[model samples]
Target: MGVRFSKFPLCWWPSSIKSNLHDMSDIDDGNKNEKDHLPGFTEYSLDQLRSTTSGFSPDNIVSEHGEKAPNVVYKGVLEDDRWIAVKRFNKSAWPDSRQFLEEARAVGQLRNERLANLIGCCCEGEERLLVAEFMPNETLSKHLFHWETQPMKWAMRLRVALYLAQALDFCSSKGRALYHDLNAYRILFDQDGNPRLSCFGLMKNSRDGASYSTNLAFTPPEYLRTGRITPESVIYSFGTLLLDLLSGKHIPPSHALDLIRSKNFLPLIDSCLEGHFSNDDGTELVRLASRCLQYEPRERPNAKSLVTALTPLQKETWVPSYVLMGIPDGSASSNQSLSLTPFGEACFRRDFTAIHEILEKLGYKDDEDVANELSFQMWTNQIQETLTSKKHGDSAFRAKDFSTAIDRYTQFIDAGTMVSPTVYARRCFCYLMNQMPQEALGDAMQAQSVSPTWPTAFYLQAAALFSLGMDNDAQESLKDGTTLETRENRN
Candidate 1:
């Protein structure tokens, strides 16, 4: 069901998707049919596109580059006067006539927020051309690994890491296939300086049509031995990606190379980052990547979990792409970015106490102040993030981790945030679990304050009040209660 897999002297992905790669059989153009359409989306062919440029001619060729090997890239002018990249591979080398069409279809169908979009492909008899959005900066590999370019800063490197993982995630979910290939050579940095993941021609489609092939060398030991394409394989690749990011080098000939596993690899990281990187965080990320690259696919974290792990890093300050913009591959957006704000920098430095103090100051009661919505939401989000982290003073109160109950209510206090009384009543139980009677009472009161006409908040308030031994106030508040759900929940 997966690529043509074999384990002789350790398993590995075949050299070319067009040649050695199997199971990605010669798919016919007719596969694009009524049943094949993605959810709420339509499919298209090159004919539907405005037009395409044709040339093996010297005039149309913009530049020829060689890193691993010589790649002939052509320059074409679109109707919009935009110059695009077209890599015309030798068709004779390909195994099938329809393979190019399928590759085009697979790459073109993906619409990512963080990857370079595949425009279309021209199946000119034997020749196959993959047309793509013209990226000015070329590949991230060029700058990051190049001798002339400045070293990639720590934050910038992290942003690219997030973008790449998200791109792979998008590809994995879209075609129902695993991205078996995630080498640095495939990731191109655009003119706006954002890394755009490319090389989906080798992407493997799963049952749902959104997966990539497993790079055997990068494949976890568990999956390297199997023909299955699991997220763990991607995780293995992610670990390799981390190695690539830190070292600004290609993934080694072997699978599962970690910065921690080999001290030699740790020093291989990009020297341009001023050696300014988190050994702790990088080590954790490396270990996580290593887990994904485990001998078994079952040990790896899924893309969603990867997203959660990388979410905190997203909030930190990263250098803006000098003049480049990132493009979406299959999973990311055309533009994944961050700010260099002072407060953002402080958060990155883990100055939580300073941030907490700022929030407290902003929360001050000002009779003259017309509800500071932005400030309120900022403080609330901060509080929620704090409560979620283990280091936070409040996370110790989990009655089997029921923080979401209070989170929703706390969210309501944010400047622009608003929640119905029903939601507050739900969170009150969470506060009660944490033995936070005062906080529960506050949530209940805020719910009532937001909508005094809502009867449920009063019922919730009554329950909280009674718990606090304010029986008389609870009875008085109950006078306005009427909603059946609230009353039942309260009782």
Candidate 2:
């Protein structure tokens, strides 16, 4: 077997962290001096264990993680009488000290409810222990899926996605931290189903892509083949998580990336849901998940965009009075008719257009009735612009005018609109037509994040990933698409 050693590169560390890590790196390689590297232990050792790990034991085993790793975790009371979960490091050859120190340093700077907070570590001789706050419910992988577990409700599933993404953003925005690892088993679900990103031993600062195989579903085909830890790789993993949350499928040894990459992702929702969720929200979640899985790392959005994109899928928050002057156009009136009240009759019967013309001459675009309707203007000006460009882009795509189409669609997306999905869909279609498979998948996934119940959005993503040789994931996408198709037909 090939042996490997890992360290967060000094260059990648921010100045604040570099100062703290300098002294820790100086900790002599005592085990190496005393003897050769142990067969089962990693570079981590007992001497390097954190001081906070005063008391830890096997009796505290809270719950087993997934099949991905064999770290036996224990939830125990420290000597100080605080509750903590301790995970035993599995490597027998290298010392546990290095991993523990890395986690400690990471924990020292990172703090968010979405991420499990490290309580301490216990490294005595060969034994390595990670003491963390004990979460009541186990990891999300166990509950939402697993052999006999009940499926989560749609609301809970969306909450998990939002909370989990927030956690990733929390990590990504750190001065020098990113969740290089975000597998399902590492995602813990609280009683309310809010997620806490746990397990950091494998969480490395080095972007060299963990030099090992993980659940294939979480690894993009590129990473699977190249063994590179990249930002896009993390997005791929998160996208797999979205699939699992939506379909309740685990990342099998072979994988699940392709499974949910279909046009009919609606059927991927839990059957128990009995069709209870808002279509718009569901579509958004599925799309967001797919976007995170773009094969090319650069094409995927960073965590900030993800959070901003998924915010609409969350529960209602109060909008300030000033925030919304009025509802968007279509929102105010139904398809029935615009009955004129006495005041309205006076307004409409008059020379409104002529008055608007005068106002325009006076340099008041706002005076126009249509301009006052935010949704109408958005749909007409912005959405229509996107649609128009997208139509032109489609023709250009068939004619092999890829560069021109990409430019056209890019402009449409850059020009703001009310809905994220509208631009996402237009841009996604544009990318696909332009022969940019990665960009197609990225933008399509973004569209889904804005509207998950829509199978078309999901299917578009499946087509993109499939074209790029992510065979396993493509297969899954087809399956999800089929499921949604059947459901739509039944409807």
Candidate 3:
């Protein structure tokens, strides 16, 4: 017979909170002011929400666990045809209506592109609900673990890491750093297929103690010891997320660390991503994850540092939402369309000579657009500028002028058109030499993003993490670097 596990509480509030219930009226007023300032937030009537959810029909239930769960979530369509996800707190979850409203309002005030934007809330005498923008692509868990079609691409996974870190950074900046349940399920994919952190995690529950819906192994050590989560604890959770992205399985942190120590990451990586990522990219991500999973919360890198570390791993920060979602372009006869544009086809094929011949024959010799079309002129110009800047930066780097190298590389990066991995790697090295591990990590990540297969990026990242005293992560990076070198030698 299977052992049935009891449902965990949603959140923990102090026992004294009930005694201070009268003061909650003042809190409600403050929440009102917050709600007023929150541009898109709304106080919806109970009837409106009920109607939208088709009277909370079972068919509307969308929560991963289903309607019987403690806090049920439903996908609903509003009268205006706006799709939304509504969370209906169990009656016992928040008995204090005022407290619930105040908490909801506080969370509603938070706004960021990475967050599933809260749209409205409802608080009747015995009913409480929070509504957020409906995510079309489902939760990250479904795509990562139980994908029905194709698995998530390596590029998309890397992008998710950067986006998630930025989201955490934004939340940390907004003073909402303590996420109640931070996990893959908390990440939902919006209409554009971009991952978004669910805002429901921001709301504080009325339960008297810390809650854990997941396994204790995944919970931060501090939460197990003190039964409370801090900002750094959230960072710790973020580290677990990195592990999730890398492993594609729910391995315990301790076990993961053991695997890292053993240099046994090959088995940890998902089979679906076998050839999708380079050894260096995997190693760098693992190392960053190890830092986040550090036993001491204070020792973990902050959200900003995490953002810097992950930013460079992104392949294209501005990929169209549809492409990220893997939605097929509906345009008919794409091959015929391509055939009509010989210049474009030639450019796509990287046949510069053919492109130039076509442009010259088309009588557009002087036009900048034609010039660019002829020989990828814009990219060529940007490369020339990048090379010039990189040369100066390389000179400074060789001369032991770390600061100047950083400055020159900063200019190169600011130009925003070049995608040179060498520049990023050199700048990362300079940042490390100058004792700027965070910036070094960022540069290393950028290098990897620009050239995912390059081993040097991993080596630089490992060096920076080592300087920051993140030994496990550094070791992981070294392992990845070695793997990449081995692979390169074999080729």
Candidate 4:
């Protein structure tokens, strides 16, 4: 069992990996709650967040504007297989670190079903990043304006408005009155396709500066005059979003108001929604939007009032949002193996033979060094021994002598001359073969710490967790592995 990991570059990972291992311990001890909610507010280390997002790779970017945007968000998977959206701010965005922490901690205290809740924040040196729940279905901007499958249904639009209103109302009740840059982009759909307002807007971008990033047409009138955001300003932005949902495209508030005044409702309404709603229903929604777009911020209705008005107009309230959006239901899809990647499918079925075949085919591809030139470290005697141990381990693993593989791999690991996720992954597989699920799990988690985006590490973890009878966690790991594998293939 030892494999030469010298080909893989050595990395100085942060203590976040230790934190993740501690969390795993909690899970093993049954101390974690099984409910669908974040445990508590976390002040994550910058290195930890960096590892989760694969060093903030462009391939994992989820922001609508991609890398060009002032603030960029990337999709990341935690060691526990939970998806997170990490928003990295510009260097000078939050100069006051203490102020940023205060804002993030306050926002993280909120736990609302209508909001894509803040989970943590990272403030180390010049780095400032916020972590929140990741929405798989994408933003309202994608579904409402640039739909791929089909335009959002009328019932779903109504639900979006109501849920957003509820989210704002919840924030207001919590003494957090101001929301910055509220727009269709701030709205995202959860796994169930239900809309939830992004919690990122709840925090101030700077201590004392302008926060609005959208065009003046979408900006609240009061904000233009004073360069400030208030509760009523959020309501004004909500009205513009109403216009977006009513019409198929982005319309300036002034132009939409003009269309409303001329009673030219035909151009203002989305053509796809024509046969879906009654004239009275459209008129009622139009009336609400007009009220929200009033010239004076004080004249706009509060979040609760908007919620009340939109609630009655909701159609098919009993039906699931995923059903109306024509997306796959997460619960139903979790049981099916048809859409899983090859590695994920093997893990899901616990087919060790298939897993071994796939791993052998992979053969430390990610472990290859970037440069062909040799380094001074390569001449060290310790490096030679480490390479020898790994070579022996690989031979044993291939020959199905798992016990020998384990001993050789342990020697390489204890050498500390090199760090390789492939080594940890191989050792994890060996442990699994020896029927030591806990040992297998430790190695798998270690592999993730060394290389966060390695799909094989996640797949091995799934197999280990399944052997331990942690089927739910195993399924989650399988999903993450499948997603990462798909993304890798795309790139």
The best candidate in terms of lDDT:
4
Please report how far candidate 2 places residue 10 from its true position, in Å: 53
In order, what lDDT does every prediction score?
A: 0.50, 0.52, 0.70, 0.81
- For candidate 3, report its TM-score: 0.60
Error of 4 at 227 (Å): 1.1
Q: What is the lDDT of candidate 1?
A: 0.50
TM-score of each: 0.49, 0.48, 0.60, 0.62
Residue 162's C-alpha lDDT in candidate 1? 81
RMSD (CA, Å), each prediction: 19.3, 23.3, 19.9, 18.1
Error of 3 at 48 (Å): 0.6
The 10 consecutive residues of candidate 4 with the worst lDDT sum are 9-18
List model 1 lDDT by residue over 448-489, tens digit each. 554444444555555565566544344434433433233334
lDDT of 3 at 29: 29
Badly placed stretches (over 4 Å) of model 1 are 1-54, 58-71, 93-95, 202-231, 251-259, 262-268, 315-319, 323-491
Model 2: lDDT to the true structure: 0.52
lDDT of 3 by residue, 1-491 (tens): 01111111223111111112122222332232121122367999989988999999999999989966888999898876678899998776788888888888888877666888787899888788999988777788988888777777878888788888888888787788888878999999875566889998887746742556888999999999998888888888888888888877778999988988898887668788888778888999989988888898889999898788777787754454447557542221222332323433342343435533442353312222211122387566676886688788767866668799889978877776555666666666676667777676666666555455555556666666656654334444554555565566688
